[model samples]
Target: MGQRTVIPFGPQHPVLPEPVHLDLIIEDEKVIEAIPQLGFVHRGLEKLVQKKDYTAFVAVTERICGICSFGHSLGYSQTIEVLMSIEVPRRAEFLRVIWHELSRVHSHLLWLGLLADGFGYENLFMQCWRLRERVLDIFEATTGGRVILSACNVGGVNQDIFDEDLRGIVRVLDGMRGEFGELSKTFFRDRSVQNRLGGVGYLSKEEAQDLCIVGPFARASGVEEDIRSYGYGGYSALASFEPITSKRGDGYARCEVRAREVLQSMDIIAELVDKIPDTPLMTSVKGAPGADSIAVSRLEQPRGECFYYAKGNGTKYLERFRIRTPTSQNIAGMTKTLQGCDLADVPLNVLTIDPCISCTER
Candidate 1:
């Protein structure tokens, strides 16, 4: 047998912003197997459901991850709506869709920057983040918070977009479309990026499906299971909406899938703004009494499909709240992809899974 060396990749690595430890076993330059250690950032947020009122619990859900904050809150709200059988106003749903897609764009741009940084492309990283700043500015203007929007509520949204603000958002997204197209072209077509990412850390479609990967990870492997297809929020009315999928299942494929999604999200937002129906933004939600009714709700967050389970026990406080984020589901597939990869490709492979540790631990 050849000599094998064990190496610890992270709990606090420069490449990863989140804390995820990987114990890698390698022979020379090729990784043989990887053991992942999670729970470093576990905050026990799930246990808080019993202590906090249903309304206040939204804040806890939003804290799952700074990047996917809106998605978490929206999923939480949707779950509660299911439990209460409340039909959110059409306008509120549209607004929620707008914020959700904006959050998606922002999150994807942030990931693009991080991926660029991982590859030592400092200028590309900076450019991606500069574009992300525009999305953050829009979030602050509409929701009063840059990272955590806190705009979603149980029955509806807390804020409404004025006609002027709507037009401004459209203009910003239109401009961003051109910028994103250029950036994506450069990133995808550039020889250096292609050489580094193409055919690296490949996950076959069968492997991805067998392991049950989620979000862009699964989409890259030709899975078409986007929760948006369920017609929740305003997605049902989206005329040109289609979930992006690729069969290559490599790092390059994951990047391409995300880039395509960014464009699709922008298109959805534009359609939403154009079809804005005049209606009240919120509705009063009253408690429904039963023997702790539970409901499941799922949404296609930028990271992938997020699952929320909520149980109400005829009280202000929820009896139980469980959230299963996409990252949690993708962990297994990530470990599988790490096999036979070089140590240098680990970061990109891990990131291709988009490991949102906070969401997983919560």
Candidate 2:
């Protein structure tokens, strides 16, 4: 019989930048069971929506998670758009798709860097972040903020892109593509990274579907579910977009899924730059008509699918607002996937789930 032991993995850890806490029950060096604790960063952002007008509520939504700020704001705006029956211009929708994919690329790059750092591949970590900086530069150039763009508004977006700016973005992405390819090969083909991540903490397709997993986590497990396919944003007009999927449902598979998606995002952005139509960027959003109107909206964020529900009264302020982030829905599956994995594989396993505590707690 093996000796049993319990180890606390986080609340505060140098390797994990996020504040998620996990307790691992181990038999020797293998994990037997895993438990997760959340709510360490809760600030009740959902409840604050009732105090602000529908337009002002965008600020609160953007703060749901720093990494997913754009997606959060986009989701909130879409919900309000639905509630108010606003017809967003085609150009604005395409712009939304551009920024959305750009945000996705930046986010996946950040995760890849963190994953590399977890495995002690400091150079690889730096390389991934170096490429990610170009995406941030594009964000700052267009939206005025690197991390939290806060460019989404209720009727449409708050910013516009010019022809010169679009050309600059395309050039930067072209440069990033070459660098991304090299770094991806180094990470995926390296024996050390493969040994640490490949086939580690696997979840079967059935388990993933049964648990209602979202985003890359589910896509890696062979779930062909993507919110973009619903044509909520400008995705309906994306001529060459495809959802990235893998059947392995393991840590390495998740990494591959995100890496491939990053390339796809670049492709989407390039396509948009070539075809961006000239139109008005903003539509004025007036007050809500009644106090009981409600609408639900969902978006395919980089992490996963984020859902927002907004209810308004016959005033400037909303009556209630609710958000269900991808991380919150995937925590159960993440813990289940961690069981029976090697202790050394803990960081990769947790990261494969892309646990965003800020989104989960909020």
lDDT of each: 0.88, 0.87
Highest lDDT, which number?
1
| Residue 260, model 1: Cα distance from true site in angstroms | 1.1
lDDT of 1 at 21: 96
Compared with the true structure, what per-residue lDDT tens digits does model 2 show for residues 76-115?
8899888889989878998899999998999999999998
Given candidate 1, what's the lDDT at residue 335?
90
Reference-based TM-score of each model:
0.98, 0.97
Q: Name the runs in model 2 displaced over 4 angstroms.
A: none
Which 10-residue window in model 2 sums to the lowest lDDT? Answer: 284-293
- Clashing residue pairs in candidate 2 are 290-313, 290-314, 291-313, 291-314
lDDT of 1 by residue, 1-362 (tens): 56899999999999889899999999988899999998799888888988888888888888888888988998999898888888899999999999999999998899888988888899999999999999999999998999988999989999999978998998999999898888998898899999988988899888888988889989998988788877888887887557799989898999999988888888888888999888998889876524569899899888888888887788888787888888888999989989999988888888877778988887
Winning model by TM-score = 1
Each model's Cα RMSD:
1.1, 1.3
lDDT of 1 at 305: 83
